[model samples]
Target: MLLEGKIVLVTGVLTPSSIAFTCARLAQEQGATVVLTSFGRALSVTQRAARRLPTPPEVLELDVTDPEHLAALPEHLAERYGRVDGVVHAVGFAPAVCLGQEDGLFAAEWADVATAIQVSAFSLPALAKALKPLMRPRSAIVGLDFDASVAWPAYDWMGVAKAALESAARYLARDLGASDIRVNLVAAGPLKTVAARSIPGFSQIQEVWAERAPLGWDVEDPEPAARAVVALLSDWFPATTGEIVHVDGGVHAIGAAIRPPAPEPEPEPEPA
Candidate 1:
């Protein structure tokens, strides 16, 4: 019951396999009333997924890139719930050309890159701004991150966008500090979510992560990351902000792969 009596908003839940879906589910299980956001043709899919949650919560239409949607979010939340205790910015995307290329950084034109950056990075502030009115002191904002410190093989522009997101979060935390609203991120390891599978070479990252994570990694299980999000949403992290909590099973901390011990030297049977 980490988030008892809290109202958390979760976005980008396109399917039940999405990490956002798990986050929303766990939030409700922990006693928070959760609301999900989706847009356009995917709204139906999200609605379907919502039914699968422990408590089927209301799903709202929210295309973060749409200013109309962003502007109306506060009013929508206010209508249903007087205030929001937590916000989960789980929205992100990039054009196919923006990834899966050796020249990925330069592969996409400015227009494509702009979309990626806006959705994956700028939306954090936009969502915060829209919901700021309803957020009181001790309210928290958490976004999903992918450890944008290092460039990945096919992550390309999306990786750049995430780096921008990390920076944006700090700026948000700094600015929102006056209001006592905490902002943080959970950089999860690779998971078998719809978004992850869409990336061309993401599987390679998953393979390597599974091999190196000291605490072990499971691409199929998102509960660990989900739990982290709910914890931040709860009053438990009242004093924490502007931090990136890595839930990648220790992969981010290890400098090298944890190779297994060399097979025991075969007992050299000395046949005299």
Candidate 2:
């Protein structure tokens, strides 16, 4: 039990297919007591999904943008478990209009992009800060990430948000390391979750990932990614921090072209 007797908070679970749900499930199986957080209309959905876990965790109301909820989080968690050992900041969002509109690209408006940055990037440090007092020393903070190394067709603002997220984790790691708390990001391969389905042209990215990754990636299997999160949440990575661990089937390393080599000339056989 890597996480035996630990208490972990996982945010952004909207359905059974969500990446956060899988992380919570794995954490429970590893002997950790898990708690989930959701907002407004999705609270019911998250609750239903929580029941499906091996050991259903209590669902808490948390809208990352709500300062009131953020301030109440430490006390809220303390009411249930007394202290927290880890936190999974798996929340992110961006309006569809800002994704990749040709005419609207430059004029898409900063409001949407700014919201995405705040939720996907800045909220990480915010959550860490809010939960710091309740979090035990040597605790860990893990976040979900995509390969933000380059631009994808319709991943526009979200891509920029992820880039900011990667940078934010480094800063969080540096600041939190002095307190013996570790922060890291897991760059996972694509999966068909509610949040992912909301993105435009996500299928195209999924196809390219399958074609390029040498290990033959499975977009449906988010377990591997979840397992990586759980491992980082544990004590195994005691000396690790400010790192972006790539769990993308090695696709990030390979070039996009997977076409077979051209056939050799038939005349060569006759000459022999």
Say which candidate scores most in TM-score: 1
Clashes of 2: 0
Compose the digit string of candidate 1's lDDT tens values, residues 131-223.
999998999999999999897889999999999999999999999999999999999999999898889998889877967899999999999
Mind giving the per-residue lDDT tens digits that candidate 2 earns over 58-102?
Answer: 899988888999999889788878999999999999888877566
Clash number for each model: 0, 0
lDDT for model 2, on a 0 to 1 scale?
Answer: 0.90
Candidate number of the best lDDT: 1
Please give the CA lDDT of all the candidate structures: 0.92, 0.90
* Model 1 stretches astray by more than 4 angstroms: 265-272
RMSD values for the candidates in order, in angstroms, are 1.5, 3.0
Model 1 C-alpha lDDT versus the unseen true structure: 0.92
